[model samples]
Target: MMRYLDHDHDWLVAHGAIHTAREIAQQPRLWREITATLQASAADWQPWLNDLLATPNLRVVMTGAGTSAFAGKTLAPVLRERTGLRIDPVATTDIVGDPQAWLDPRLPTLLVSFARSGNSPESVAAVELADQLLPDCRHLILTCNPDGALARYAAGNPRVRCVLMPDGANDQSFAMTSSFTSMFVSAALMLGAVPLADAAARVESVAALCEAKLALWPQRARQLAIDGFERVVYLGSNGLAGLAEEASLKLLELTAGRIATRFDSPLGVRHGPKFMIDARTCVLVFMSSKPYTRRYDDDLYAELVGNGIAPQVIALGTGAGDTLQVELADADDLWLALPYLLFAQLFAFEASLAAGLTPDNPCPTGEVNRVVQGVTIYPYPN
Candidate 1:
């Protein structure tokens, strides 16, 4: 009798969207599970991580590919500020392409991989390249699949630690939903963005807020889909910019490229990307909670509404009027991202349905895959 995005299980299953709908709806639950799971697994990863993090010359690199890659981008900004460490969000694709350039053999390194499957060709190859190229590289792998190559890569290696996400976080859907958010927050918590005492509370608060958004957003999402936007743009700043990238990708993937999409920061969009807006376009701005950043977002939002370049331009954060409003005040942009993400995922799902495409598998011909294929990983010189 479970329902998702206002659609019952039977209806969703009949439409071939059961996986996508259920996965999107279950993210808040998976996020809560991540808090408890990480807390319980602290005994295993904390000792090694504490000492590694304390290393004076340590450089942390977060990596993954595709949607998984976006997780690093979303987190790297805040994690750098909170941990007071040099955290670079380097995609696995970059590392695999040129290991010598990306993986520094000279510095003491901790490679934190945020991967959903852990089996992506680049994901595995990047880890190997790091080991081959760096003398002092330690691995912290956060992934959903325990049996994925990245997890097994830790089996006998004392330099590696694998942390599995909560149940149902593996994401049966083609696009990442529960898997992405769970790993996104998992990296935040495990890397000391929130205090140990406050981690569980912070997670619980965001999860509950997102639970409410899951209910409120679906109807609006359906209406937006019905209106049939031919182009979409997502805007934000800092970590939210990364969230914007993922948001843009979700809509693009769900609609099977029927709707073109672009993402940029509020200020950056004015540079040139604003031209993506047209009469049939939809523009969504992910407003930051920070006062300074919020001003730029306000400027952009007001300009978008005033110019009327796009048919629908909206703000997705707290404000007095016409904003979708995530409704959690005084939270970090890190936490605010979760509820905002829920809205994007739901809208993408509805857009897929409105386009008469299967939300679960928008690409039936196998051009795009749930897991990427056909990439040959060459051996790196030892």
Candidate 2:
């Protein structure tokens, strides 16, 4: 009996969740494969990136939509510090709408686009707008589909470079599971200031950690999903806040919005978003690995646990708290992000099953699509 996420393969397929479950379960192996793939092909793309990154006053804007967009947001702060480059994680929706506001035609810019399919109308529109507005602009597209629009756009274009993730990184599930983390890892390794040798080692460690979590989290997550919770809150700080956004979305998406979800920074929640918490809320905080940042995360963990409002408060990462710890105290937030994302994905999968919804396609009516349909891309003014 072949099983994924502790459920029989036939069982998941019958429930229309096989694709989502397999994609979620296969992420750790995909992480290792992508690292190896990137390391092998470094010679081809490294020189081009070296020149672009070395540009004076270089501004790197990472853009995508939904989960793809969250990947850049999660890594932007860390990359800014590590690469010593001015990096902003902007959304393609924002870029396509008002190109003049988000883009500066004067600066030498590296537009890093993250996408699973690379077919979003706004995504391709953003790339075209950058070429039109910024003469000094160069593009780095990280996509899973080699045949995607962005990948096709890279052909015969000297200003663009496209890196396809491992073969199966192209997820088939309506909700992105492996594709999100694969792109996130690829971006951190290639774009962040980490050396290639060190980057390889980091991927190994993080992949192992997540593999263990995937094996262990499914049953526990299923139990939590059946706990009668009405709302879920995901809280984190710094880069992890972007992760929290992705996590919150995963739950809402997988459960077809049957479970209310909210995401915020530990401190930011107090500014008024904390009102989402009640007796039925389950709060999961992605604790930071940095000591200073961990202090803030720990403070929120204690406050949430002591508040007597939410029924469950989970703080997982470096330090000990109300919930379990990942033993990644010294790991960079970027590496720790993989395992954190795995847990969130697992919980979302289980929550979907508990809600009697199909994780593969929660919305069967074509209202919310896998590739995002019905977006009309209008031409930007010159």
Candidate 3:
């Protein structure tokens, strides 16, 4: 009767179908809004970005907390290859706890902060710490909330640049559906892909594909969630690896950590984390679109299927696979993340319900939060 948990098999099946379908429909709206924002603001962004690019020794540090951190992680490697600049996704939590290790006083760094609310304590603290530790530091704040701390941070500072995403990107949902995708797109445009005008076609394609496809994912995800797995492991490589991290967190947060979760690269997992797999676990592998990367992913999937460590193994790919194949026409793995992530999010939401937890606020007991709590900001010594 519309309760949180999916008790009936029929109910779970129906829910997963609805969730996937909605994602496919909503993705276009998201893409249009994002492209329009960039086109309108190109004049301002182009000059600012060009100036930042002029710096010879540019160190780009993508900083955020939780899922925001994953956004950076997903973007950093691609940015390094595309821009030929040094980029790293450093968690604000890590920086706040230990400043000296992350902040190099010698390097001329461009601190790119990805924040959804822009008000999180670590978000603000990371920016502040960069200013304190790095002598030649500039700020480039990407956020959905214009009134957020990161957006307003550039008000008087000529050195700081702030780019506000589309209004819908500041998603009001319990989870970061549009917000996550929008921010990731913005970073890709500003850092990796072609100019705003050039990127319009590809972005539109990606959005259209996702909207057309999301309708049926909810039912699929619901079934997977109700499979009664007690553990989940997400695997990917490169940028998709960062997405795997985000997927893992989504399941853990939505389920209030009731389901033990872990994420690692396809190659990295073989080294040690493979032990996390068990008979009751579900392994979700994000296969790459590139031929080379896909080889590694294919090998690991074969190993997982052959070893039979887990009862359920799901692999998301652009084409056919042994199980749970979600085709994405001819898109790259980077863009494929949109559909893969939608599936993961729906799975986690359904899993949360199956575990008898609320999706809106999974942690009422106060461990994890929408905007994390109880993080005391310490004064750094000069």
Candidate 4:
């Protein structure tokens, strides 16, 4: 049996976790492929993207459901700061229910949809509603499943441009691992302010850093998993704050509610959410690399340590003495997110295993599904 990280394939497969484990392990390679693919295909989509971005008063809305939705939340801040574009990260669930609240009929809108399966009811409905409500709306569909409804919906449409993620990005696991990171990297490279060549170099550096961290993380994650923490809280700032949301969801999904989880920005946690911490809780803070943001992150880390309420507290970043360090001092918080996320992913995977739940499909009872089920689409009143 092949060994993945610390476990043999037979053991992982018997535990129903091989797919999830393999998917998590393959992210670095997949990210490289995504970067290369974007660079190679820039000619086909760049003109369209350039033209749409060039439009005065263009609103960029990033939409998706579940983990896919978190992608937008993570990227929108960085994109807005760097590109100076008016970008909004709205969930498809929200858009589907009330299009008027999100879609502006007066502005030329670019709907950037992120989906692993591309078949969610809300995802498809959001695209359709944007077209109906906004006369000058265009779509840039980023998805793993080419045959899915969202991808197929873009076929031959002059107003829509669809980009397929690298093969194997369509994660077979119930939870998204490789799919999330691949799509996140793709969008960062294509829509971010960095030039393609520079973006590729940054990606390479991040990927290598992650590869090194992944080698050392599984052991630490396994230890944390078996440490008997009943709750986990993830905290960060800015883009990393959005990523903290996704990281929190992974543990909740993989453990099938065996471990309760919550996420908040470093500064935001001081409000009411800090009450979630207790003796049985484990806290993971994703520290920002930016000097300005790192102050807030460090202050929270110090406060948490000083409180001594949680059983375990971990800080992740390029800083010294962190539970896990990636050593990318020059990298921005956006680039640092990749490595920080990998730590969260591995921890969730190990925690699931420790809880004796199937990482591949935690709820085999069908209450939850790989692709969400039983969602009904309602028509918008004209």
Model 3 over residues 284-364: C-alpha lDDT tens digits? 999888899899899999998999889888888865664656555567766778878877887887888788876656676
Candidate 4: stretches off by over 4 Å: none
List the candidates' TM-scores in order. Answer: 0.98, 0.98, 0.90, 0.98
Q: Which ten residues in a row have the lowest lDDT in candidate 3?
A: 15-24
Give RMSD to native, each candidate: 1.1, 1.1, 3.9, 1.0
Q: Look at candidate 4 and give me any clashing residue pairs.
A: none
Candidate 2: tens digits of C-alpha lDDT, residues 126-166: 99999999989999999999999999999888888899988
Worst 10 residues of 4 by lDDT: 320-329
lDDT of 3 at 200: 83
Q: Whole-model Cα lDDT per candidate?
A: 0.90, 0.89, 0.80, 0.90
lDDT of 4 by residue, 1-382 (tens): 6777679999999999999999998998998898888888889988889888989999999989999999999998899999999999999999998899989899999999999999988999999999899999999999999899999999999989999988999999999989999999988888965788787787888888888877788999999999979999999898888899999999999999889999999999989999999999999999887889989989999889998999799998777777677788487878888888898899999999999899999999999999989999989987
Evaluated at residue 244, the lDDT of candidate 1 is 97
**TM-score attained by model 3:** 0.90
- Candidate 1: C-alpha RMSD to true structure equals 1.1
- Residue 69 in candidate 1, Cα distance off native in Å: 0.8
Q: Rank candidates, lDDT, best first.
A: 4, 1, 2, 3
